[model samples]
Target: MLRTVSVLVDARDRAEALVRGHEERLEAVAGQSRRRPRPRVYTEEWDEPLITGMRWMSVLVRIACSDDVFPEPARQPAAKYRIVTPEAVLACRPEVILAS
Candidate 1:
């Protein structure tokens, strides 16, 4: 029917407009600087207890578990355990602390 066709056409026009808006936003973001801001240097000395506390340990654990920090192996079983290294933990410290 003509009415049904008109409704479908209107729906498509709205969808196309939404897609265009998304594409424009993506392009604008892509045009900006791609460089990551430098991590802040810590001037104040951290207390030994605070650094070794449960809260700090939890933050390190969360960062270690992130996919960016350690990419998951392809076709690996979900139940398989991956051992996190001390080096990896040290490397991601700045990112975790600065939240960059």
Candidate 2:
């Protein structure tokens, strides 16, 4: 998630203007890169992911899924870890809203 955020902040261009403005440069870099330094980003949702230089990301699931993962009450869990159910996640609605 952090990596996604970093990409959103650094790599993604909001306006078509940048692409339009760099039409010549875009053509120049059709496949090849100039090997230039990009923006430095430090994001943390789980970990970070890189665009050009490097990236880091965490692979994890949350909450609990299946009695096997969490086990029922006193029962010993058979699985090593549990995964978060999408429904549990979706249960919480966003508290904030944004307007233009």
Pull out the clashing pairs in model 2.
Answer: 48-56, 49-55, 49-56, 50-54, 50-55
**Model 2 regions lying over 4 Å from their true place:** 1-14, 30-52, 55-100
Please report how far candidate 2 places residue 46 from its true position, in Å: 20
lDDT of each: 0.38, 0.27
Tens digits of per-residue lDDT, candidate 1, 9-97, equal: 77766666677797686556544423434332211112321122133333333333322233232123331333334464466563533
Which residue runs of candidate 1 sit more than 4 Å off their true CA positions?
1-10, 35-89, 92-100
The C-alpha TM-scores of every prediction are: 0.33, 0.15
Clashes of 1: 0
